[model samples]
Target: MIPPVSAPDFLVKAGWPGAAIVPLAGDASFRRYFRVLDGGRRAVLMDAPPPHEDPRPFIAIAEHLVADGFAAPRILARDLDEGLVLIEDFGDDRLKEHVDAQPDNEMTVYSRAIDLLVDLHKLPAADLPPYDRAVYRREVGLVTEWYCPAIGLAVDEDAYNCAWDSVLPIVEQSASPIVTVLRDYHAENIMLIDQPEAYGLGLLDFQDALAGHPAYDLVSLLQDARRDVPPEIEAAMLARYKALASPPADFDAAYAVLGAQRNAKIIGIFTRLWKRDGKPRYLAYLPRMWGLLERDLAHPALAPVAEWFATNIPADKRHQALQEFALA
Candidate 1:
């Protein structure tokens, strides 16, 4: 919760004075942000819910990304005491909105955007924490537990075992050292705005960036929340990434595993979001996204686990649950 600390008081505390403050937009998180207007300069103020939201990691990663030449907004002042940050405003324009209005230019923008991943993944992540086996397994468990309950598909023991068994091995075999996995590296998080470099992707909503595989972020981008990314574009991005990063020949297999894991978690998340958060609009995206998960499973890489999803989880039931919304 942002205290009643006046914008003037914040400016005074930060040693910058006389700035007109305006509220910025925020999403479904404990954090609230405001875009401050000071003279001709602008900055963003972040108010994170204390106790539940920690500013330390957000500040730490912000510093690292800025130092690495990624266009993360500069952190001007972070009041750890109040869970507030007076940071540079990266503008409000996101890539999803940009390309949605101008579909003809998607490939051009995305090709440049995909290149940014190369910059992020090439760095050493020794300083970052791990998105290790424990977290990975727990994330998958959410799908079976939360998402399945919405449609009443309690995955049997064998079915549950099948998913983890196939996915766990691929994750373990990835052997790729951990890097800053921007957990939700989608178009909405990226600002497609004016910059000296054409690829100056303005990043927002990155507080959840973790230490994990490069493949994880890639999956996040290609399997985006707001749009159905074309298959050719996805493959092209992967090919471009592989050419530069020199990931193993089986990186695609790892990507398939990560994609399945991520999409499953999202299916559960959309279900939970609607049922728990009172945000039912997300439910509209399930049909296309479910089909996406189904298509991903067709890959031989995901064959072992696909049967569990198909056998234990019937599509007819998924469609039936979906019907609950249409009639509403």
Candidate 2:
């Protein structure tokens, strides 16, 4: 509960001068956000304190997304040295809250989200780290290094690395056009902006954007780790995306590979959050994420990873220990 060190001074210097700043909910990152009210104007004050969080990538990516005609928040003012930025407030209508409150809008909102990806993927992934085999392996490795140990399962790092070594090639072989993978493009990060001339989806938490398989973001959208997107809706959206965008050869296989990779990484990440970070709420998502992981592992392309899971983690044992840890 450490208050953002520079937020107060930064806000005053930015002309808010003790404006009514209400704390907004933070995400998994170290960054904190506040809804700042100054007279009749309202903006979001982002506190991305340095050493732990950097504002440069968010700033650069925001500019890049805005330049590309996307709905990323406009950076009204910034102090990169202090890792703070005052950005356009897109209001409280996060796509998750919108769709959850009105289930009927799920289809329309999700369709438009997929459409945003279609438009976004048409452009190339510009200057960013490549989401290649090495990076992917390291990410999923969190499972072996932290999760397995936490669940009292011995991990052979060699075998775990070997399992991913077999799977990474499939993800890399996609013939589809690669685009900037917005690392997190789920319901929560998307904003519902109803305007005639808008991208319709206000993007957030894209500081970790990278150059990688186009299917990565799609998986993030459809197979969300935090929420359940109805199976029928997910299927239809996948079909719709394929129909509208001529995805490359082996798109389905590539999608499955990326899905498995991302889910496996999440499984490890959630466990670490509970055991090390003492964030028990994240543990609740483990069962849901396990289901998603199981679904992804069923894909033929992920057989190696699947075999590794079956041998190491039986279905009944998957989240049982983690659940107990959550209660404790």
Candidate 3:
């Protein structure tokens, strides 16, 4: 990521000149977040300093989420020119932290999350960029671009894409009315709210939401790159979601295809984080991600991708790659 250009003086410029600001955790993007305080009021200050980051997409998506009766932070103020926005503060009870503290409640927690998705899927996807085949192909191409070289495998971009080309259409043909895909909808980005009427979940990091296949966010949630979701919990939640929502004609196959695509893309992304950005912590997720990919590959619809992995990356090589990159 490029260095942040300058601190936005927007809050000071707009009345609360002495608002207390404290740094919060950031993700892979160029955007930074800060907790802001003024008198008794609290809000989140998003520092999305541009030429590298944009705030419009975030504001648009947050509006959509709120309009749909979901728990997205309320935008209090904005200065798009400076890439700054002050949003409501949904205080600390991230789903991941809650799950960590009470593992037994995992099923209940996931079910509630699934309920939110079921409601969201009923509505029309917002006017946003489509997560179409071209996008899927480009993203999945990450595995070939970064991962293969990291593990000392030969590069053959055309052949790799050819393999995915055969499989990706399965997703395109099966998807129905698209829904808002909060592309990063997972445990880390979901905050558990305490208020009874507040939807029980707070959405975050959704600037990249797109009109995408419904199964895409499901895959993101179940096949989380950052955590080891229990096999039983994943299976149960998937079943629960399918039972509640009227899914597409080829829902199972579409889910598998998107899961495989997401996992493959993540492998390359984690490798890039290590090699290009000096972030090795992401490398530790590689082994788990590999395991998830292998499971997704077992789906019959993923035959071509599975075959590609089998021929180019044998089990021994796969294990070797994991051992080489994963944390001890």
Candidate 4:
């Protein structure tokens, strides 16, 4: 994708005239990123077109994270009307690629990530929206609304809502302290930066952050949809966080609930990206998401939702069905 028409002027105003703008990446959203190079200096230009996207929340959250000593990209300049922002470049090393290249270092890197979250949870939550029952219901409802229809299954929508209603209160009453939930805190969004002070990880894609249960972000990391985090590593990371943070007895249950909730939302989202957004690449990840969701459903805390799934979606219609659909 070409840079937005206003990008050159914005870069010039930001003091980087005649910089080379190269496409960096585009995510599941309308936002696109480009790398800006001028002489020896480099920065990233975020193009979040308005009407369908906004950069204000990203700007606010980035500032908050930087001020708190977290390694969020520092915003250099912005134009709200055009939805453009020039921000610091965290370079090319993503935690996902790093772990994939050096499997032996997975434990060490994950320990550092867990420690970062432990420290992060100690701070006061940012003044953001709460991840409450309404948000949880809406997110989890995506499975019923999008995925089920796409797979040609007419589920009991009311029963699905009721199943979630029974178990969401468990998450709300979790003993862990509430803090900023970087709703998409996974390996791909984490940059392996060179700064030791920033714990070697630079945060990204946290604009949708909310004040919610601590387990939410942890679940996002260990139960990643795009990558496979071995069950042993997931267990070790959980132990590491619990030892560092001393969260209450229900932390495990909270993790399971949030895992199921998040995975369910992702399955629906991937389907929607294909059906509504015409982006079929995301469908490749559906099987992995279903696997994680099934594991989460096995937890005793998820019995209500588990029963709902067992009754509505037979075993053949879960991951296997998605695989067949994708191949077709």
Off by over 4 Å in 4: none
The candidate with the higher lDDT, 1 or 4, is 4
lDDT winner between candidates 1 and 3: 3
How many clashes (backbone N, Cα, C below 3 Å) per candidate? 2, 0, 0, 0
* Residue ranges of candidate 3 with Cα displaced over 4 Å: 1-8, 319-328
Q: Which candidate is the best by lDDT?
A: 4
Error of 2 at 75 (Å): 0.8
TM-score of each: 0.90, 0.96, 0.93, 0.98
lDDT of model 2 at position 214: 90
lDDT of 3 by residue, 1-328 (tens): 2223333467776656777777876778678888888899878888887898999999999998898788899998888888888898999899888998999989988999988888899999899988988899888988888888877788667877888899888877775667889999999999998654546999999998888889989999999988889999999999999899978669999999999999998988888888788777787787788899999999999998898888887776663474474443
Q: Which ten residues in a row have the lowest lDDT in candidate 1?
A: 319-328
Cα lDDT listed for each candidate = 0.76, 0.86, 0.85, 0.93
Candidate 2: C-alpha RMSD after superposition = 1.4
Worst 10 residues of 4 by lDDT: 318-327
The digit string of per-residue lDDT tens for model 1 on 21-78 reads 6666656666777767767778888887578687777788778887887877788987
Candidate number with the higher TM-score (1 or 2): 2
Best by TM-score: 4
lDDT of 1 at 71: 77
What is the C-alpha local distance difference test score of candidate 1? 0.76
Superposed model 1: Cα runs more than 4 Å off: 1-8, 15-21, 175-177, 319-328
Considering TM-score, which of the candidate structures 1 and 4 is the better prediction for this target?
Answer: 4
